[model samples]
Target: MNNIITIRFSALLILLVAALVTACKKGDNNALTPDLGTRVAGKYTYSELKTGGKTYPASDTNLKGTITLTRQTPTTVAIQLAIVHKATNEAFADDAAEDVDVVEAASGTIELHYNGDTIAKINGSKISIEGEDDAGTVFTLFATK
Candidate 1:
């Protein structure tokens, strides 16, 4: 009985060590390349978010806001932005992104997604935000940092 218990303990220890070793991995010497840098979160000058190769609305061109993106985990990020509503004349800021998946684009473009749809993409110093409003209007914000 003592020998059987000792053998089981030894096997468990070896298995735990093996699993830990496999979980922790390292890339080459130059794993992190500064060429694809993170976009600085701050007040961004507004531009436009276009789909189907065309602008959505003419009135949304003059919007302004402050956006900040923070990393929550290795693969998850949080985005917060506050913008002034032109029609309502009120500041609308939303930090509703709970656990968004972030992936690095091949050409230094970072794409953000929730569920399965791509919500936004950060390309170089440009940030584009798009979402469907309650009224079914596609709200789009294209800004460059």
Candidate 2:
């Protein structure tokens, strides 16, 4: 009876130690902080737009007048485009603010994702977006505050 009790206690101690060790382990060093998103979130104007080997200036008459980046979480941001006719601005999503994931690839450099695919990147104060629209027109937008 004494031997069985000793063995059980030893097994329990080992299990507890393993669980604690795993729980105390640190995660990725490059993990983004909430403040980082806040620092990057703000209004930015369209500097340029490119598609099919043609470069054009982005204006209210041709494209989105401006874009606002709002922090949704430590790892995500909500991008809202300004509506010309709306009384108040809203998110890009039709129903809810669809958040785009923000990954800090390196210091001062960040990647943006939607639906698990990278669609944009932020370096310093500028944001460069490359993606397709609903009409299948691929475009790249460069904007800065």
Task: List all candidate RMSDs to the true structure.
Answer: 13.1, 11.4
Give per-residue CA lDDT, model 1, range 32-124, as digits (tens). 633222333344545565655577442545455656666666677677766666666475446557577877767777888788878778876
lDDT by residue (tens digit), candidate 2, 1-145:
9999999999999999999998995877656544556766888777777788887765532555566788988778888655232334333222224588888886668887888888668888888877666688887777887
Residue runs of model 1 more than 4 Å from their true location after superposition: 1-45, 49-62, 86-93, 106-108
Candidate 2 Cα errors over 4 Å, as ranges: 1-34, 59-61, 83-96, 106-108, 133-135
TM-score of each: 0.55, 0.56
Per-candidate Cα lDDT values, in order, are: 0.66, 0.71
* Model 2 pairs in collision: none
- Roughly what TM-score does model 2 have, to 2 decimal places? 0.56
Error of 2 at 99 (Å): 3.4
Model 2 — which ten-residue stretch has the worst lDDT? 87-96
